[model samples]
Target: MIRAILLGLAALACLAGAAGLWLTRAHPVEAARFEGLTGDAEAGQTLFTAAGCASCHHAPDAEGDARLVLAGGQRFPSEFGTFVAPNISPDPDAGIGGWSLTDFASAVIRGVSPEGAHYYPAFPYTAYTRLEDQDVADLWAFLQTLPESDAQSIPHEVAFPFNIRRAVGAWKLLYLRNEWIRPAESTELERGRTLVEALAHCGECHTPRDALGGLRTGAWLAGAPNPSGDGTIPSLRPEDLDWSASDIAYYLESGFTPDFDSAGGHMAAVVANFAQLTAADREAVAAYVKALPPE
Candidate 1:
């Protein structure tokens, strides 16, 4: 009887190990969609701005034209640990110059690396995963156009079990999906939805998370404590927003609300990115925000 019990336990352990391996397997997007698309560098620049790549990739003090230099040393403080952005310059030895277009797309859209490793979500691929294949292609082209910088990537400061990057595969299995989050009723709303849910990744800041740091899908974009763990990020629901579509657009464009209240704190940086976009884009984003359910 004792021998039988031990055998049963051993069999269960083997099953558990197999399950773990399967759950953590690398799953990449299909190449059929990403292949053969010629990217336009001019249009790619706009996408880059909308995606706010410079906000994280550029050196913290980079200003004006210097923002174009993608040396990538910005520090992000989080409960898991601090993440240092990587150098994405065109340097063959030190930057992403070694990366193939497929490699780039896989990393940006699937959160998987060329070596089949999962990337920490700090890179915002969760939101970027919403990007169309063509958009990813264009973003890749624009990144290639950036000047070469020989700066090596600063390593992440994650501690203990959190530092075990392989464990992130299970997290990806739970939270990562390539599909659109909600159905859209119109072209305007759809356009805005893509920006808010995808490139803008608004929920990364506004939405609360579970104990494991995954976004709380039920709450969606409802307010939560900031990732930095200080002040709270405001809810973007229609009721909480308290702004007309026009007001929201105006704020996005000029950082000024109907009452002339200027955007402050982290929103200031967000506003800076939005200001680079055309008037139509801002209006679309505003319209989408106004249409959300009052949560």
Candidate 2:
């Protein structure tokens, strides 16, 4: 009886070890190709604004209210747990000042950090992955140009298993698709598609969730409830609203809905970021999104 029990225990241990090995070994392949690209500070500025980096990381209550400051104390709550945004200022000790361009690219595109830990999807790297190599490099350069902050980042208050970074390898295996955006046959529309995929990240808030909390592919950008602890983010479905392409473009750039009311919730921040984009790019996003089939 003792021998049988020991044998069963050994088998379970072996199985667990094998699973762990499989999961961790699946770390994303290193693609340092982006390191060769020359970054444009001008383009980076636009991308930063389009990506809304300041909304979560900058200290909204700071004395000077500087948009460049990275106080790193904002808390984002979700179904899993609360994730505090980190300080990305040029601070070598407290922020990402020490990060190489490759490190930044990996975090934005592959969802892995400089410490080789997986960032929770709540960081929105899922949408960021669509960014082009040059854009990622430019954004990194722009971040490095910011004033470094001494404020340390707060740890995420996620529960067990969720706090374990190794488990995230499995999550990435299940949901992350490491592919570049392909251009369509239409030049104008294809440019719009690329801009939407990279900058607008429309799918992040609009797509429905799956059983494991991953985005549902077929329902991309159809509309989902906001997970940002504010009010619900409404559907962008054409059938749900009478908004035209120009109306959507105007709203994105100005935070006004078709009803002439000011936008609220997280979308207000998104519109604030969109406001910095060029009229042409904003129009591209509007055209693509408005053309999406109704849910």
Candidate 3:
């Protein structure tokens, strides 16, 4: 009887080991590449401003809005816990000066930093993944132009299993699409679709989250509760809004609603970014949102 019990325990241990191996396996995807270096620092600057990289990461109290200076210690409270945005400046020690272009691209597109660290979705890389490789490269170049700071990044204060960085590998496998936005031949709206998907990343905030905290695809851009504990993010569908697509476009560019209310909550920061965009890009985003079906 004793021998049988020992064998059963050993078999269970082997099964557990196998399960662990299966769970931890690295499923590598093809790395994205950009060719010919048409990346313009100017264009990248526009994209960066539109994306609102500074609103969350940069310390609000910093003297001037210099990207090189590390103004750490901004905390964002979420259901998972408080997440402090790290300094992305070119700081050799604390920031990303140590990163290569590939490393930077991985962080933006794959949500994994050079040191194999996983960034919380609060960093908004889900939307960022829609960016083209040239755009990503340009953003990298623009970042390099910033002065390097010496601010040490703070550790994330998330709870148990959520704190495990390797677990993000599972999250990526389930939700992230590695493909770039493809232009469809169907309509003039196709370019708008590409622009919205790659640049706007509307679904990140507006879509509902699944049990595993991934966005539910079928409900893309449908209004959902704010992750920042503020209030609900209202639907952008044309049916829901009493405004026209041009009105929406104007609002996005200028941060004013039809009622003359200023964009608030998380959207305030979003509008700040949008204010930096060109007239054409803002129109594309508005056109795409107006085309979305109502939730």
Q: Compose the digit string of candidate 2's lDDT tens values, residues 53-154.
A: 887788755543486697678888878889898888888889988877888888888888877788888877777877778888888878877788989998
Highest lDDT: give the candidate number: 1
Query: What is the Cα-based lDDT of residue 18 in candidate 2?
Result: 93
Better of 1 and 3 by lDDT: 1
Question: Worst 10-residue stretch by lDDT in candidate 1?
Answer: 26-35
263: Cα error in model 2, Å: 0.6
Model 3, TM vs. native: 0.85
What are the per-residue Cα lDDT tens digits for candidate 3 across 121-210? 777777777777888888878877776767777877999888876777667767777454333444546656655565556666777788
Candidate 1 lDDT, tens digit per residue, 1-295? 9999999999999999999988888777667766788888888898898888888888779998788888999889999999999888878877888888888888998898878888999988989988988898888889899988898899999999999887999999888877776678999889899888998888889888999989887788889987776799989887787889999999999999789989887788789999999988899899888888866
Better of 2 and 3 by TM-score: 2
Q: lDDT for each of the candidates?
A: 0.87, 0.76, 0.72
lDDT of 3: 0.72
What TM-score does each of the candidates earn? 0.95, 0.88, 0.85
Badly placed stretches (over 4 Å) of model 1 are 30-33
